[model samples]
Target: MSHAHDLVPFFEFHLYGKEQIPDLSNLPEPRLFSTHFLFHSLPDSIAKSKCKIIYICRNPFDSCVSVVFHQCNCTIIITQIILEEALERYSEGINEFGPFWTNILGYWRESIETPNKVLFLKYGDLTGDVTFYLKRVAEFLNCPFNSEEEGNGVIENIIELCSFKKMKELDVNKTGKMVGKYENKVFFRKGVAGDWVNHFNPWMVEKLSSVIEERWVWSIFLISLSNTYISIMA
Candidate 1:
């Protein structure tokens, strides 16, 4: 499921302020859910439970670009603004589920403090070394592949099935509608890192870099990652 709302209807209801909380007693254990909600805003049950969270954060530049295209394709009333305006709003943390730094840092700190509960993954790192990270994820979920499974090419098959190209070609993804409105294909854009350079000019780069430098200074790891992205894409 793409979101928690698919299985737990009340998550959507709660998000929009509907009072009804659906009974989840019928759902089986080990239920997987995904959300864009901030760390602090998550339900108390989740905070207190022994559930694991895997947060995959993309470089802000690419994230902003992707959000722009996604909103424009999925929403009506033309939420798509010019890149310049989008960059301004993004830098100011005005977009959906933003301010980006706050959202990232909240999870970043939590992952540090409670490593077993939160596994923080960087999108760039995952794409760069899928095998290593995929194994990491499997291990994190307590289902690491045995040597027999590895020899049988299970990992390779899983990677190929989940690859962006393969997923984009799937009939369900190509023609499906999500949330009864969004075309599932909208989520399958370029699916590559560093595509932000095509959309960002020199000024935009400087502006976003300044924002990251200022806001992310507290986290050396994030700042280093941001700097590496800037350098590679420069």
Candidate 2:
């Protein structure tokens, strides 16, 4: 998902969504772009550039649920796709623009290897403390909040603007269209971090947990995220 994507002021495109030619690369200093491409598949120019990348990873449970909801709604006609099928595809990394593990772990690994260049944030942590992370984001992008900006409540204003309650109610989001397949309104589903709990049955939950263990257990990706202070504090 592109659920909270609207808050990012200037992403050229959601690379995971449609295969449109992105007009992003080589724009200037501090251009923002979003992508689901694995580290191996990322365009050579971007990987080699001095650009900073902010990649957010949601736990597989929630990511899978969100993608399922998104797929069900984006269809033109009613389809009875089941949770089991979605979970199976997700675990196998067979979903669109996936293997989900590859997309996630590739960034996770890069963020570990090049912490300064890739600021990896967890979706749960970000929504939990937008103020702190927003400040971190600004600082990472080299436009940190100064004393003057702090006094002006710039951080608070930015927090309120991107808050779920505020963003979901905006008229532009209520009506705007993107990439033709996704209606903007559909993107604003319940943004709670562990929303997967409400939808996943016991078997589905077990399968994802197993997949997570098998795929990430030995990987330094999530484990090493602590080095950059982007992962949650103990």
Candidate 3:
């Protein structure tokens, strides 16, 4: 997902819809891009190549709440719609690409089974140690992260650039438009981890847990493997 203002200095091919993937023959071999497109729908090249895939996910309950705020604040169609209606629209996958669960599960499975290509990340982990994970991402993508600069300011730069507060404050993000027409959207909503604790009740949490158990077991494993890899690499 673009995650509102998350699209800044990092992007290339943006294929989120089912329409078409324009002529990429002119594009460079190793291209970078973001998409709400699920793994099942990704281009065949993605799976076969050595390209790195960073699949970031949050707890469904928290994701759902954040998504609610995102829809209301960013989307033109849902801006005037009631929260319930907006949620219904969300469940129906009326947004940028399609249904959230299907997309989430698709990547979850692919990332777990194919670790060399996909690196599944958690929003909570990134929030905890933004710099560390950013470095990990660099390593995963085979991008240069000079060992000589470990104590230097590189980490700080990335953290500051990618910080929720900073990204949200960007004039372009705060006012720029995307899939929807509303410009009031902010990429960084309360980027706190476990914010779901404040909103989810027993029933709701149980429901979300059941869904995760049924469809996201592989994703959970991928997260575990990712954590291990990060620790070892670090």
Candidate 4:
């Protein structure tokens, strides 16, 4: 499944305080799951296991805008806040699963320390060249496509299947609620990088940029990383 909430009851409880957790032991091996939990918070078993972990970090400016839309759209979560208020919260690292740099840096450090066990990907780089990154993911998972598969357009087919436009149009995604009250459609916005530009004013840009700069001042790697991602979109 794409997300832990899609299968595991433990994750559902952890994320939304739901009491009913289903039995997942019967599921087959090589099961893939995704989560937003920080590295420090993940189960001990996951850390000890040989399973590969891929962490995708996004540009903070676009992340903030997307999160605000998610929170505001899900009325059951909290009272909807305006864009200005959301920007302020994001500047302070106050959103859900936030302290944003901490989350990114945690996995980043792990990826460096144990390169085989963890893969760090930037959302901008993935968007900029999806086929390259998709192959990277396949290789990382030990399932690299052969020349014949590539020649047969298997890679292209997978990309088309998972494209935001295609997935958003699926009946399963377009209909029904998830995690109790969240409409499935809320998860599918524009799905494009750099959308923050449309919502952010000069002041918003300055504020977030200053925060990112301050947060990454000591880490030359992060500064370079952020610059590379931003430049890709530019």
Candidate 5:
């Protein structure tokens, strides 16, 4: 299970929405579901229930650029030109759905508070140290990798299977229609991190950070909020 956008990257993986997931009320215990819904957006049952959320995040600049590239190549779904027009709009904080800062803060705050329920992952770290993070994720998922039997090759296998080049070449990813919308864009497109450096100028970076710090005060407040809320609500 994974995000709709994350589908092409993980060939042979199934994708589903939160509401569409099995009831789990009558089911046996362990369950798994990958979702795009943020912390506040999850259902009350799932929020209150015992379930792990692997919150994978990448640098906002890179994420924004990737989203634009992915959207542009796929049926003109998100008709925003990041190079000039969209960049102008982004500077003024005019976007399809508010700013990207808000979206990132939602998960960042969640990871800080509910450390047990949520595990924070950076895309840069995931690519740089795949095995270390994979082990951490496997442990969180309760699917411990047997290092003795597999001799660390198991981790490499998983990562290789999900690699950008490999996934892009697979029939399931390259040919199959994903989520009935996205096309021409494969799941894996230049999976390298820190690519934002090539695109964003120093001024742009500082300006974006300032905007984030100003626009997402709610997230900051939430993180420093009373323990009463955490005890009562969470």
Candidate 6:
């Protein structure tokens, strides 16, 4: 979810492509990778590889608010546009590598067709039940902890190590600049589920809901997400 300006510091890897080709030669095994390419546009090698791919998506409402904050805080040129203007550009897919719903379709369908290879996650569900998803992800990676490791709290240690609270407190996150335009610290903003409620008015919510439903109703993942949004807001 980190933007171009703050990606490197947030993920601790040098930022290279914004959906461009990934050059992963000579990288360490068990190397982590990140990209913003939509499923259809992903590199042929990666798509055909036996490797596992995990795609995490956020609720559209919160995504809007997050983009607004990041732009206002990080870029002087982007700061001039009001939230309303930004939302329009967002809906048009004119924002930063956006057209959010489009970016999701390929991966979303792939997750359904090849459930074992493509693991789809929601930011809401992950934060809501990190431990459960952590175990699920570990299992998918073929490194599930043995009973002895579970009893020894190895998973808990890993979760604690990567928790938002811990990451936010790290010296690198606090003091590092991303070698881009923005500070690393901005990527850690308000890591919560319902932050959209603070910025989105009733009309905005209904508008975004309609748009999301229209564009993303094909996948079971997005259908469930739309239902969750309705139930929570109701």
Q: Using lDDT as the measure, which candidate wins?
A: 1
Q: Over all chains combined, what TM-score does candidate 4 have?
A: 0.83
lDDT of each: 0.80, 0.76, 0.66, 0.79, 0.65, 0.75
Q: Which lDDT tens digits does candidate 4 get at residues 1-234? A: 233246433353344355665455656777656677788888787887898999999999889888887877756443224777888888887856768877887898789778999999999999889999999999999999999999999999999988889878877777676766667788887888988888888888998899888876656576568768988999
Query: What is the lDDT for 101 in model 1?
Result: 90
Native-referenced Cα lDDT, model 4: 0.79
Cα lDDT of model 3 by residue, 141-224, tens digit = 888589767768877876787677876776666565554544544455677988866665576566667655755576667767
Superposed on all Cα atoms, the candidates' RMSDs to the truth, in angstroms, are: 7.3, 6.2, 7.1, 7.0, 5.4, 7.5
Candidate 4, poorest ten consecutive residues by summed lDDT: 1-10
Between the candidate structures 2 and 4, which one is better when assessed by TM-score?
Answer: 4
| CA shift of 72, model 1, Å | 0.5
lDDT of 6 at 154: 93
> How far off is residue 2 in model 5, in Å?
13
Off by over 4 Å in 6: 1-23, 74-81, 218-234
Clashes of each: 0, 0, 0, 0, 0, 1
Clashing pairs in 6: 93-99
- Can you rank all candidates by lDDT, best first? 1, 4, 2, 6, 3, 5
lDDT value for model 5 = 0.65
Residue-by-residue lDDT tens digits, candidate 2, 124-195: 999888888999989888889999999999899988877888888877777756655567877787888998
Question: Candidate 5, which segments miss by more than 4 Å at Cα?
Answer: 1-31, 74-82, 88-98, 150-152, 201-203, 216-218, 225-234
lDDT of 6 by residue, 17-125 (tens): 2456445565557866666777777667779889899999888888888888787765554333376677777777786565898877767768877888999999999
Q: Against the true structure, candidate 2 has what lDDT?
A: 0.76
